[model samples]
Structure formats: structure tokens, C-alpha cells
Target: MNFLIRLLVTALAAMVTAYILPGVNIKDFTSALILALVLAILNLLVKPILVLLTLPATILTLGLFLLVINAVIILLAARLVKGFSVDGFFWALIFSVVLTVVSSIMHSIAGGNND
Candidate 1:
């Protein structure tokens, strides 16, 4: 199904991004898959709430505060998922940014939905 394909792409991207970032570590492809799922769930359930709560700061920073929120999500994912670790907040920030880029590229290559 479409969801499965997208999940695979995300897992691939996570593995690739982890390989590129020394401060990030993923145990294996399975861990990457779990990481992707955890991230999706967090984004779906938690990110919106965080965004709403931080709306003022987000507006003040011209949306830059979203990056901090992304890092927080990544750190939370790290704690929730076994076999994945982010060295610190700085690494979490870097990991989230790089993972976004990698996942976007992979999704595009996989003919992902524009939405």
C-alpha cells in the first residue's frame, strides 16, 4: 500500500541520515523502521499540540522555533525507541534537519504524494 511504501522510504532515509551524522546512531534497518513509525506518531499526535502551545514563539521567531520543536520530537523519539540515540540537543537538531532533507529526497524519488 502507499503507507507501506512511504514507511520504507522514511526508514531508508533514516538509515542514510544516521550514516551521515556521527552524533546520531541507528542500530539497523529494523530500528530505522521503528524510528520512522515513532516519528510519524509523534508528529501526528504531539507536534500539533506543541505547535499550538508555541504559536507565539513561533510567530516571534518567524517559524524558526519549529526547528526547536522538531529537535524535541527527535529527542523524544530517541528516548522512546530502542537502538536509536541522539548525542544531545545539538545532535537532535542536526539529525532532524538532515533526516527531513533525506526523507524528502527519498520520498520524491519514490513518487510520494505532494501533500
Candidate 2:
């Protein structure tokens, strides 16, 4: 299905990103898949609330505060997922940015519908 393909693409992106970033580690492809799922869940359930609560700061920072929120999500996933870890907040931020870029590229290459 489309969802499965997207998940695979995301997992590949996460694995590639983790391999590129020294401070981020994913134990294996399975861990990358789990990481992708956790990130999707967090983005669906938590991101909206976070964006709502941080509206003022987000507005003040010209929407850049979303980057911090993305880092927080990564840190949270690191804690929740057994084989995935980010060294610290700084690493989390870097990992998040890199992951986004990698994911976008992978999705585009995969012809994933922009869902």
C-alpha cells in the first residue's frame, strides 16, 4: 500500500540520516522503521498541541520555533525507542534538520504523494 511504501521511504531516510550524523544512532533498519512510526505518531498527536501552545514564540521568531519543537520530538522519540538515541539537545536539533532533508529527498525520489 501507499502507507507501507511511505514508511519504508521514511525508514530509509532515518537510517541514512543517522549514518551521516555522528551524534545520532539507529541500531538497524528495524529501529529506523520504528523511529519513523514513532515520529509519525508524535507528529500527529503531539505536534499540533505544541504548535498551538508555542504560537506566540513561533510568531515572534518568524515561525522558527517549529525547529525547536521538531528537536523536542526527536528527543522524545529517542527516549521512547529502544535502539535509537540522540546525544543531546544540540544533536537532536541537528539530527532533526538532517532527517527532514533526507526524508524529503527520499520521498521525492520514491514519488511519494505529498500527504
Candidate 3:
């Protein structure tokens, strides 16, 4: 199904991010998949509430604040998922950005929505 495909896409992206960034460590493909699933679930369940709560800052920063929100969410996922770890907030931020970029590129090549 579409959800499974997206999960796999995210897992691939997570793997690529871990490969490219020294501060990110994913034990294996299965760990990447688990991290991806947790991230997706957190983004789905918590991101909206965060966005709504931070609407003022988001508007003030011209939407750039969403990047910080995303980084925080990634850190949350790293904490929740075993065998996946981000060294620090800086690494978490970098990992999230890398994941987004990789996933976007992969989805573009696959003809699917990156989100």
C-alpha cells in the first residue's frame, strides 16, 4: 500500500542520512525502518499540535521555524527508537535536513509524494 511505500522511502532516506552524517548511527536497515516508522508516527500525531502552538513563531520566522520543529521531532524519534541515535541537537538537526533532502530526491525519482 501507499503507507508501506512511504515508510520504505523514509527508511531508505534514514539510511542515507546515517551514511552521510558521522553523528548519526543506525544499526542496520531494520533499525532505519523502525526509526522511520517512529518518526512518521510522531510527525503525524504531534507535529500538527506543535505547529499550531508555535504558529506565532512560525509566522515571525517566515516558516523557517518549522525546521526547528522538525529537528526537535527527529530528536524525539531518536530517543524513542532503539539502535538509532543522533549525537546531539546539532546532529539531530543535520540528520533531519539530510533525511528530508534524500527522501525528496528519492520520491522525485520514484514519482511519489515526498511527504
Q: Which one wins on TM-score?
A: 1
Across 26-75, the per-residue lDDT of candidate 3 in tens digits comes to 99999989988898889999999999999999999999999999989988
Tens-digit lDDT track of model 2 for 1-115 = 9888878988999999999999999999999999999999999999999999999999999999999999999999999999999999999999989988988898888888766
Off-target runs (Cα >4 Å) in candidate 3 are: 113-115
Which candidate comes out best when scored by lDDT?
Answer: 1
- Tell me each candidate's TM-score: 0.97, 0.96, 0.94
Estimate every model's Cα lDDT from 0 to 1: 0.94, 0.93, 0.90
Clashing pairs in 1: none
Candidate 1: give its CA RMSD in angstroms: 0.9
Global Cα lDDT for candidate 3: 0.90
Candidate number that wins on TM-score, 1 or 3: 1
Q: Record all residue pairs in model 3 with backbone atoms less than 3 Å apart, i.e. clashing.
A: none
